[model samples]
Target: VRLRHALEVRSPTFDTQQFYDLAEKYGCAIVYAEDDEAPEWPKIDLETADFRYARLMSSKPDEPTGMTSAELDAIAKQTQAWAKRGDVFAYFIAGAKVRNPAAAQALIAKLA
Candidate 1:
């Protein structure tokens, strides 16, 4: 956790098992395909990455943050580096860590 914090990463991604474990423990949402339909590697463009991010964000608006190519590349590098560490978690909390129930209700509405 500290390592990710130091690197300014909120999410800690791990293998499938560890990912689920972390999500369960943290009461965060889990996003995955049981059939191992993982996203392809060496993402061709932000659109591709956006698709994955949209899945994580509940497939609402897959907006690209307009980060520079270098900045996005850095993020990809870091994500890959974290993956190399192996045995991590992909727990996600609210973007702002807000405790309001409204966010949950909003998501429920979206999914419904």
Candidate 2:
């Protein structure tokens, strides 16, 4: 079986070109995530891996779907842009437990 690995850099110190270089050298994909507790990417670029992976973690605690239309739109745009370059796997998991499915569907609709 082939080996596939992903790196989720949670600290700003690791969000550097050198980190990406190491990831690329090891054929590891960098995980792009949106979370209140995690450091976001300094820049959204797709030069580190052949594929893309993202964890959509930015959602207000009170928002039913955890995300608003504007947020979904922004994510859609980014996902589309990344898709043009290669495959993108995004998960909407950082929101209300009951709303994640609906949020994901809404985001899918936006992407569609």
Best by lDDT: 2
lDDT of residue 22 for candidate 1:
53
Q: Estimated TM-score per prediction?
A: 0.23, 0.83
lDDT of 2 by residue, 1-112 (tens): 6666767766678877788788999878888877765545543454477778888777666776678898889889988898887778888776456677877888888877
Give the top-scoring candidate (TM-score). 2
- RMSD values for the candidates in order, in angstroms, are 15.4, 2.3
Candidate 2 global CA lDDT score: 0.76
Model 2 ranges with Cα > 4 A deviation = 39-45
- What's the count of clashing pairs in each model shown? 1, 0
lDDT of 1 by residue, 7-104 (tens): 11133344346544554455443332211122431221111111122112111122233223353354445445444534223222323234223333
